[model samples]
Target: MTLRRGACLLMGFALLGGCNLSLPLQGRAPQEVSHRTSSFEPLAEAPQSEILSNLIQRRSVIAEDSALGDVARVALSSGARPSEAKLRTAKLRAEAENKNWLPTIGPVVSLTSLGDVLASLVVDQVLFDHGRKKAEREFAWADVEVAAVTLSQDMNDRVFTALSLYVTALRGQEKAQVGDRAMRQMRAFNRIVAGRVTGGVSNLGDLRMVEDKTQSILSMRDTAKDEATAALAELEAMTGTRFDGQPVAALAGLHDDGGAPLEVLKADAEAKRSVAQATIQRASLLPGLNASGTVSNSGSSATLEASGETGIGLGTGGKLKAIEASKETARRQVAEAQEDAARKQSRLEQRIASQQRQQAEAQRLAQQGQETYRLFQAQFRAGQRSVLEVVNVYEQSVRRALEGVDAKYDVILAQLELARDMGLLADGDAI
Candidate 1:
């Protein structure tokens, strides 16, 4: 029997080793991926109005459409041609110029007919001005820049809105949680009061008061639920996805470190804006280069007739002038982009500072609430306080706790907003 037991124990040890028991065990209870446990969880799905605002500012439907429309206008106004059209036009013009200079080489065709063919080619080539081509390229480039900037701005704004919604929702959810706890406590007190009245230890008045307070808590809870629902809907609309009713992930605790310097960011944006403007201005002064070839055959005799020309040509006219005109426009765009960046930076700093102050005030209030609760508890325990007094103190404590959570969320939101304004946040950081 002892031998058998030893063998069984050895087998168990082997099985345990095979099971990789050395791996660290997860501390949380088994749960679905959708289920989350955090005071800030509900707010995770909450819509951030700020992120929406930012998205609207950066990449709204109107802005995207406008950018596209501008690109189209640039293409049209600049007379930018498709690659094939440009190649054909270049070839035709080059052939025309060549015919104008070089005598037609073909079978013994009439000199009068050759002269007519050469004249036609020259007319076609001369009709397309060099300035027009240059202007088209410049306009195309400007349109590209406009589209890029609009897209970037749109993405930035959406992220900001998502972050704002997330934080606000989290604040509201935390308040709801506090209210839930308060209601539970109030219900328990109501039960206790009922038992006391039944046992003749408490009067009818006490029971009725406790009941009324419980009803009041329920009312507050309903209001919070409504607010949370609205926030969730808003969040869903922005993200264009559904959340499984999970809470938002908690942000790291606040640190005393200040936000990034707005002046530095403004300077960076200004520098880039200047570069963009320079590119636009330079586009106007430069002439474009193109090469083309063409083959044509005209029958002047029963035997045969053939002519061809291949060469390079430079043309300049209306388009180049338009590009020159756009230099001032490009400079203005750079100035506007720089000013906007600067304004954003300043606003971010001010918002962070303001949120930090609010958080400090909230912490103070939470501390005061705790102190008051302790005093009230002591008095109630000594039978020096009524049940109503105890309930009020508890409710106050709950409110204070909710306020503290909200303040923390606000700080997180402010940080997120600052990050967004700096273009640090990505799509994955939407929450």
Candidate 2:
């Protein structure tokens, strides 16, 4: 019975050992993992600074500038005119017809088939028509303001998008540099291991292990390169130019210390939009005014060849009664636009705040990771820790560093977005 119990215990211990061996390596390998490392050719001697320089130069803060130009051209062609011009035209037209009730004396003329002729001149204008002219002028003015606001909004969007792309590219380039350095370190380690194995100081196993680790690093480097390439491509697409992989200018002293409050910006946009609506409403209540005049002369004689006589008169016409109905519709539309813009601004602010909080947390975690790595490094050098332990700590350090970089980038981007929302972006502030 005693022997059987001992045998059973031994078997159980063996099973447990097998289980541990089969389990995944959750911490680090007993030896460094070896794999093919990614390779990159040296940059060509050609000067590629122009490629990125052109990209920055091509980006525009005012997207609506072009659109506004187009709109202005169309408006001019269609006779929509600026607010000043429209007001002037309306005033002149109103003045010409303001004397509708006034009576005027002039020569009169008439002609008959029996060779009789009569001549006369007459004048007339609107006596009164409520507040038609005033309303029309107000509506025209509102339209002008609406166009200007829309242009400003478009400009803000364009500038923000360009800057976002620029920042992304810059971050990508930094990551690629890190990957390159890692690759170089792995290569050097591989060479050392190879020499040790040849001298019989280390066995084939150690060499193979180092080779595998190198390859893994290479793969990571490849991924980083791809990421950088994609970022550059996106930047190029935005700026409508080629990028030769030049670094973007560092963002320093770019943030505004006195950024306009979100509430203030929202209020301003709403106010301008409201004014546009009011103008439209007011314009609808006004009536149109116009005047016409005609005159003619004829030859006359005592015989059948006598020429006919001519007469002249003046009159004016336009529709003012129906405009008031249209004005009501326009007022409702303006209200809707103002509400929509406010909602968008609110959502943006919330997102930025959330990202900022997350970044702060990440930064704390990274610091902790750094301290832990230092402790592990000291322990490893003293021969009290295995190679695997040291590698695990190094991996942790890399991860923490990446997280910190990402968090920093996120914060910068959020600030940029806020600036854009407030319409504070400028042409010279690319990335």
List runs of model 2 lying over 4 Å from the truth: 1-132, 187-220, 233-293, 298-343, 427-431
Which stretches of candidate 1 lie above 4 Å from their native place?
A: 1-132, 192-212, 233-241, 244-333, 427-431
Q: Write the per-residue lDDT of candidate 1 for residues 165-209, one digit (tens) a residue.
A: 655665667778878888888888988888989999899998998
Candidate 2, 142: how far from true, in Å? Answer: 2.7
Where is the poorest 10-residue window by lDDT in model 1? 119-128
lDDT of 2 by residue, 1-431 (tens): 53444344344434433432232236654755435211111012212322122212322222334432222222222322243343345335434433322323244576778987755332222222233333343333333333333333344555556556656665666666756776676676567667867887668887676677667666766776777678667656555555454433222323433333333333443443354444444334444232212122342111112111222223111222234344455456556655765677677667667766777777787788778867876886696765445555655655666666676677667766766665555331222
